[model samples]
Target: MSKRLKQLTKNADKNFNQMIIGVLIVAIGIFLWADKNYFFWPPQLRLLMNSEWSDIVFICLGICLLFTALTGNRSRKFQSILLILASAAVAMLLAEQVWHVLGAHKVEMIMAVILDAGLLTLLIRCAYKN
Candidate 1:
């Protein structure tokens, strides 16, 4: 194979891997949404019951993955910060399970996951770019 072709192939492989990771994050969000109880919202917004924050997070992750697939830049860190926040929220919700406060703990968890996913994507970009 030509030298230029080899470089292209290598870059493509890297981009593909990044995209896969991004997609995996989104997939997890999908499963979380499917659980029903995890998806929480106000009665007024109940019509969009399934359209939870986690779903939004998943979409953002998908967008990041798409960007990685196309540009391989990994420039922004916003997504990474978002993911970390989401994970922290999940941790809080899990703790609430033991406490059983009957509060909006589950909602908190969902929000956290969404934030975490975004942070995660940003982290991935940071790792690759700098």
Candidate 2:
């Protein structure tokens, strides 16, 4: 690729929003894992410790956020691997949530799977993109 093309690609990959989101995800994960006394505006926003699933899910998302936030200027191969791992974790988390909600039957499980599948496909495509 041309020098200008590479520079543009690098700039595009380095998003401030991704970094901010990554920080938030990591902070939330830490709070959940540590069981800190953090409080939200509304009472409903508080996360309960009914199970460990949420803690695992948040950590996975935080890792994905880090991958997205820090992969800038890295080699394409490295970015691809990180993206694949992150996407897999996200997909697995979604699948697990769907499995748990199956008993409720309040939401459409098939739709959730389809949406997650689409997200996985998009992530894979992004990983392989030049």
Candidate 3:
């Protein structure tokens, strides 16, 4: 490989994980912001009403993730815990979306049950992990 290319590759390798995490965080933040602002034309049903506090939670999580990424703290335990929490939040939100799209029925119930069970399993594993 060319010297310049090799150097670029090395730099990317060094920060790949952090870069990915940072990008995901920023992407999620943008998604949340867009949802709140109704960027999705015709707009799907709101998971939380405009008066709910969940928007603030999303904003805060996004900011924290971005900050962590910018600071290059890839191995922080706090970040891991935050991610776990976020995963649960995502699962719950997804269940709501499923309900919205599928309506109140068996399909929604099955999906939500599976999602919640998976989330619970993940939480248990994370808690017990050394």
TM-score of each: 0.42, 0.45, 0.48
Give model 1's clash tally: 16
For model 3, how many clashes? 0
RMSD of each: 7.2, 8.5, 7.3
List candidate 1 stretches off by more than 4 Å. 1-9, 39-51, 74-129
Backbone clashes under 3 angstroms, per model: 16, 0, 0
TM-score of 1: 0.42
Candidate 2 residue pairs in backbone clash: none
> Which sequence of candidate numbers ranks them by TM-score, best first?
3, 2, 1
Candidate 2 lDDT over residue span 1-130, tens digit each: 6976776556546644444444544564565567543222233434443235566676766566566545463566655565666566557646554654564453545665665566566555655653
Best by TM-score: 3
- Candidate 3 residue lDDT tens string, 84-105: 6665655655555455446644
Please give the range of 10 consecutive residues that has the lowest summed lDDT in model 1: 93-102
- Model 2 has an lDDT value of 0.55
- Candidate 3 regions with alpha-carbon error over 4 angstroms: 1-50, 104-130
